[model samples]
Target: MNTKGHCCPKYVILQAVYFKLRFTLSYRDVEEIMKIRGVIVDHATIQRWVYKFMPFIEAEMKNRKARVGKSWRMDETYIKVKGIWCYLYRAVDKSGNTVDFLLTRKRQRMSAQSFLIKAIINNYRPRVINIDKSGSNTAAIKVYNRRSFSKIKIRVLSHL
Candidate 1:
């Protein structure tokens, strides 16, 4: 982010970096884009800018991420990872934005409880959670509610 001694202005460097990251374009492609924009920046320079600025950009993005809604939909399912099956526990807000996810080797009450705890820690506790009729998930929520004395409503989707 510090552009004190650079020949190009901050905006030009930022544009090149943005193009590279946002479009997943190669360094040479970004250089050509800068050339089309009359910037004349080199591919190597663009690469350097990306290497230097990507971490800062990622940190800033995390800081600017929107807060998830209070209503969440939770689920767990099997997913293949490197040809190995795993349980993917996930939660999303009513707007469909991801609240949190965890992949575990086992599908059990402990795993479900861990995922719920992680989601609550990372985001705010949901007012209500809609979930399929999974016994482990139901038990996990019940335990969490009992321990925390929280009256979080659980709406079981029997049709799922």
Candidate 2:
């Protein structure tokens, strides 16, 4: 979305978000950076801008992303959110391009299935899925393929 009101230029907003995300900068750091660039913006405003524009930016990137190959890699890792551990399911194409990711509290079969479905919807169905030796992931792929109209191959790898 373009700047509609008496707001900062779109490039400035984009630059602020880019700095904040690309670097390990806090909102205040981003604000100072923007200030050095001659754009005066509050840290809270920067936070609001990130919260508002991140999804739009991601959607635009997804639309512009290159076509993924047939083979895909799927994996899950634990991430600490606030203080508790959460499961982060992520997928990537054979070329190492990011497909999609999902964060959930539980790492169950249903969660894996949901992550796979979301990845398929957002990106594309993979011809072959390589995953670690997780029974839940295997079961989820099995159930999803069974219910899905397309037949997808699942390869269990000892190490991903």
Candidate 3:
């Protein structure tokens, strides 16, 4: 959250970043918002701030997030993002709290594996994982287990 060389105050930059991320507004919309608040900033500057500070923001949010359950349910689905088709991989604890999510351009074992790694890193490793009958998911879990040498029980649900 360092604003070392920034021309505006930290709060102003944060407000612009929050508005852009917390809503569906475009960069120009955030620029207009700053203008309404008497801050003369450009949309491109807001975009730069988001790109610069997003990682730090994500790390802070992850640290503040509640611990997930030991049991998890993993799934993936095809979704349209920015008019492009992509696969969204997600995991939720048994109590229905989200663990983590990732959007990938393809539905494959590598994508699933990367999402699993990210989820495990952000949250504790689950004791059990229930997944739909997707061979890619199964393969990813197997690879993870083999590499980590940790026994994480996997249950394949026939019906998604």
Q: State how far residue 76 of model 1 sits from its true place (Å).
A: 0.4
Error of 1 at 131 (Å): 0.5
What stretches of model 3 exceed 4 Å from their correct place? 77-88, 103-106
Residue 122 error, candidate 2, Å:
3.0
lDDT of 1 by residue, 15-125 (tens): 888999999999999989888988887789899999998898888887888999999999999999999999999999999999999999999999999999999987778
| Regions of candidate 1 where Cα sits further than 4 Å from its true position | 1-61
Rank list by lDDT: 3, 1, 2
Cα TM-score of candidate 3: 0.79
Question: lDDT score of model 3?
Answer: 0.93
Name the TM-score of candidate 1. Answer: 0.64
Best by lDDT: 3
Order of quality (TM-score): 3, 2, 1
User: Which candidate leads in TM-score?
Assistant: 3
Displacement of residue 77 (Cα, Å) in model 1 is 0.5
What is the lDDT for 121 in model 2?
A: 90
Each prediction's number of clashing residue pairs = 0, 0, 0
Give lDDT: candidate 2, residue 154. 90
Report the C-alpha lDDT of model 2 over 1-160, residue by residue, as the tens digit: 7656727888888888889878979999999998998999999999988988888888888789788788999999999999999999999999998888999999899999999999899877899999999888889889988898668899999978
